[model samples]
Target: MNNPPSGGAGPDLSVTIAGIRFRNPVIAASGTFGYGREYQGLLDVSALGGICTKGLTLRPRPGNTGNRIHETPSGILNSIGLENPGIPAFLEKELPALRELGPVVIANLSGADPEEYAEGARILGASSIDMIELNISCPNVKAGGMAFGLDPEMAASVVGPVRRAAGGKPLMVKLSPNAPDLAAVARACVDAGADALSLVNTFKAMAIDIYRRKPVFDMVSAGLSGPAIRPIALRMVWELGNALELPLIGVGGIAGPEDALEFLLAGAAAVQVGSATFAHPAAMLETIRGIRDYMEKGAFLTVGELSIRQKSPRARDRSGNTGSPPQGG
Candidate 1:
């Protein structure tokens, strides 16, 4: 019998993020991929561009109380609360397995304080991971999560120390969609020495438990992620990509290949698959194939060959304005 096709008959999907080259633009979002070990038996982990490990802290955390997740119409709400085995245990156990995956490994670090942020960075800086993504935008927690990301001054302070501790590894400061002015926050992180930026961790939202007449989770609020957030994430990516000179990793509710393509068209250097993985563990691989097929059908030679095509003046007029509208409008 004839052998089945190996790779997609499409354009190359290689991309670069903050000087680190990826064979493809598909990366697993932090806290969603679980350190690249869980999916090893199901898929070829090396086929991915990189793996952003679960958000890590200086000390282990048990996470939030009962009912950490709830399903929404087109997305999911999570109050995971940055629970992880902590950095030390991760370095000892998870790092080795990830190294075997071939592609770059980006450690996602979060902490309750600035010093802890720096400490986690310093510890990971000595490791073999390719980069570090500072999770300054997680909104599920009560303290030190979205707090650092929402305020420009606090965002800079949180990122500055981590940037210093990153050693030679590229540091990407993940921003929050909840920020009043995302571009301002992006500029602050860049000013604080962030090597790159990642837009839109998630939006703060909550689902009510109709039966209990309370919130879905013990926490009154949670981070909403999935298809419902894509448009907002794409808009933010476009805003930051057009305004800032730094590289950006687009993230939010990227559910499939088309969503990833939209992000790239909006100017993201690479895209991360987040909530989609929960429902489709092979979503990242499928998205990679889809992107390749799209490029091939569109006559694009490579992912880099694509650019954020700005609309003409006439087109902009027809589309109204390009700037962001006031919040809650």
Candidate 2:
């Protein structure tokens, strides 16, 4: 995967998330990428830096009934509730095929309790998988989703056991933006020994069906994602980046390379292509190329050279201090 193009058009797009390195910052978000085999027919899977598998659980889950997804203005609302074939099935069927892609395979695991998380983590940890993303922020699930992610204690409990189970393999705790103070939860995960963090998972939202005189989905609430949530995700990334020194993966509402750049500028070491993947299967690849183009145009040497801080006149005071600009100068 490191075979670069002939000319040195720009710096390599490959970036490191946690301690594991990726070919590029473009990763197919969990739930959207399925098992990574489906896209094999459409594009080269090896071209991607990583693939985050659908949210897995200790036991198989059928997810919710009725309409699981709905389209909105500039986004989509999903109440899929994390339906998956369980970790055992994923390892048995999905793992072998994904291994052939020659990129990092990040298993996204969710649980109703800490023990369940540990069990899933241990099972996947023993495998050839590159990492495990603890999805504690599925807003659609009633018991084990965003609830566990909202409380710092619960988040730590869930991540701590998984970290132990991972036993040195990278463990990334995916956080919810709906939480009052995402930084607090991020700090807790860091304290619990998480290798890295992915922030602004998804925000809880709803859509009504006027013609049907009821809610669009059976669950009445869904996780909102896509361009609409970019600002929220950016703010969370900035907050968490400032609060903790740990590597961050920004996820919410990233559609193109510019959006990815915003997250990087907000302190994300890398980013995941989530809902945008649903609309454009080639989105991740395009994002990778776009970032490369951006770097070359800006005369940047590496993704690491991009600062997270906003570069504005207001950012500098009259005395050129790093603090806020002088008042009414």
Candidate 3:
């Protein structure tokens, strides 16, 4: 299983996104997998399709204070506040070792302003990382703390500058589910030069501390993720798939192979496993093997063949509509 199964021995689990090849479609979501080294002794990190590094900012952050995580029904609420070692430290300390792990490396960059994002993208573009995932969930300091991903215009303002600064490297914008018009934001990003998109970053949710009669997190609201959000996340991927031509990486509450298959069938080129890893360290590897088993049983030669659209393209788009020529993976 270390090497992709030989021809005729098994189904091909490989997928290509933004021209970068992956051994399989299961990638470790950012923030959950750290810098890829933390899970080295836990599972075969190289078996993954890719690794999205922990969120990086223009400078080191102390992160949020007080209780930062709380458990809820079927999910977890987190307010980690993007604590990271910044770009310079990642380039000097983490990346060399991460690159050796074999999986494609994606730097998950976030910032408080357009210039900050552009500067980070410029630095990362000049480095050896394989791709850059823009985490647009960071609150826009100049916009009175509204997340840049919340509005189409705001999302484009930052994406345009970062796209230019990214120096043409594969750029994927991580979309927030909290947006009033997710389709509009996706369109804006594509128009602003994004090569690919990974969606439903995290739903804006909250939890209560009943005993204290207050919010469980210091920020009052935190991100909700886990099996709880999988259904909504899958619907989002399907909707976007019908409406757009670019590749999408579906993420939200994927916990197992069954969950991963749902995203693939819904039209995601790849899938990311997040909180599930904390409980099951080998969840991603299990998902990869599970998908391979599924494909083999179904006699599917490629992951794309698993899409529902392949079976009934018109079913997905009632208007018989499509947009742009497909690009990226």
Candidate No. with top lDDT? 3
| TM-scores for the candidates | 0.90, 0.90, 0.91
Candidate 2 residues lying further than 4 Å off, grouped into runs, are 1-9, 310-329
- Candidate 2 lowest-lDDT run of ten: 320-329
lDDT of each: 0.83, 0.82, 0.83
Between the candidate structures 1 and 2, which one is better when assessed by lDDT?
Answer: 1
Per residue, candidate 1 scores C-alpha lDDT tens digits across 106-212 of 99999999999999999999999999999899998877888999989999999989988888888888999999988888899999988778878989999887898
Which lDDT tens digits does candidate 3 get at residues 123-211? Answer: 99999999999988643122212388989999999899999998968999999888898999999999998888998787888888889
- Please report how far candidate 3 places residue 217 from its true position, in Å: 1.1
Per-prediction backbone clash count: 0, 1, 0
**What value of lDDT does candidate 2 attain over all alpha carbons?**
0.82
